[model samples]
Target: MTTKKIIQDFYKSEAFINVSEMEPYLHPEFILEWQSSKGFSKLDKQGVLDLTKELSASYVRSKIRILSLVQEKNQVAVRYSHFVKTVENPREEMLLAHFFVIWEVKDDKLYRGYQMSQIS
Candidate 1:
């Protein structure tokens, strides 16, 4: 899948809270990061999916703004802002963060994505 398609599917799933379709775009080792109420935190591949799946349970919306995306061969880097809110906390929080994600694809499926993120 192309980078644009990744963004597209993510947004599309945003509507239905169905991220399974996006699993293909993500590298198996994918890492998703965010700032906790205290400090920065990160999630590895399983962590990312687990978090997304859980959040989708309580959340009705998840938005991502791509600042930039550049991929050279297997590596993909993205800078973005994410807006999220959980069921317990009804207030939405917006985080402007930059991320560097390393990607490796196998069998035409995203195999791994090692990533890091921080507030911008």
Candidate 2:
């Protein structure tokens, strides 16, 4: 698959709500360097998996809206927003954050990512 397609699939996937299904989208040595409204954080593959598990437990469902995507070779840059239906009010979907991420695809899986987010 193309790098852009890989990223699109990952974001559109239910993996955020089902951690067990996320492994296939990430490389064994994946690393994510994230800068968010709160602060900076870094996570390895396992850490990301654990975090996703926590997110799955906290939210009833999650959705991603990709505003733009660009690809050059093995790298893909995407601008998107996350919306979630929290356990407390599963009937309402709230905008969680807007994100800009650049992902390096290696061996057909996401390897390295540089990400930034703004809380909504």
Candidate 3:
């Protein structure tokens, strides 16, 4: 698959809370640098997996809307909004965050990512 397609699919899987499906797309050394309201954190692939699993326990559902996407060579940049509904308040959906991320593809898998997010 194309790098762009792979990146897009990753986001889709995340929204669906399919962490296991997302793993195959990641390189062993995959890492993400995240900048957020709290501060910055560097996360390895396992860290991301753990985070997602934790989030799944609190949120009943989630959605991702990609506002912009661009791919150059093996790199992709994306801007997206994330929405989620907590298990305690399933009827009310809330904006989780807005994100801007750049991912580097290696061996047809996501090798590195850098992202910033604004919490809502």
Candidate 4:
């Protein structure tokens, strides 16, 4: 599959909501760098998995809206918003974050990414 399609499908995948389903879209060496008002943080493949697991445990429902996604060569830039409600308040869908991320696809999977996000 093309890099663009791979990245887009990854976002729309059930893996986005369920951490256990993430393997197919991730490279073995995947890493993510996050920049937010708090500062910069990084995550390796295992860290990503842990994070998603924690998020899935904490939130009852989740949704994503992809505002724009563009690719050049093996890199993709994505602008998206994520909404979720905590387990404690399942009926209230709140903005989890709005994000801009750049991902590099290698060997047909997401290898690395740099992202900036803001909480709403």
- Relative to the true structure, how large is the alpha-carbon lDDT of every model? 0.59, 0.93, 0.88, 0.88
Q: RMSD per prediction, one decimal? A: 4.6, 0.8, 1.4, 1.3
The residue pairs that clash in candidate 3, if any, are: none
Q: Which structure among the candidates has the greatest lDDT?
A: 2
Runs of candidate 1 exceeding 4 Å displacement:
1-4, 7-12, 15-19, 24-46, 88-93, 96-98
What TM-score against the true fold does each predicted structure earn?
Answer: 0.58, 0.97, 0.92, 0.92
Lowest lDDT block of 10, candidate 1: 7-16
Q: Give one digit per residue, the lDDT tens place, for model 4 in 11-111.
A: 77767558767877789999999998789999898888888888888887777889999989999999999888899999999998899999999999889
Better lDDT candidate (1, 2): 2
TM-score of 2: 0.97
Comparing candidate 1 with candidate 3, which one achieves the higher lDDT? 3
Better of 2 and 3 by lDDT: 2
TM-score winner between 2 and 3, please give it: 2
Residue 109 lDDT in candidate 2: 97
lDDT rank order: 2, 3, 4, 1
Better of 1 and 4 by lDDT: 4
The prediction achieving the highest TM-score against the true structure is: 2
- The residue-by-residue lDDT of candidate 1 on 1-120, one tens digit each, is 775455445444563244675565566665555554446666666666666677689765667776777677754666666666666675865553555555555555556555566655
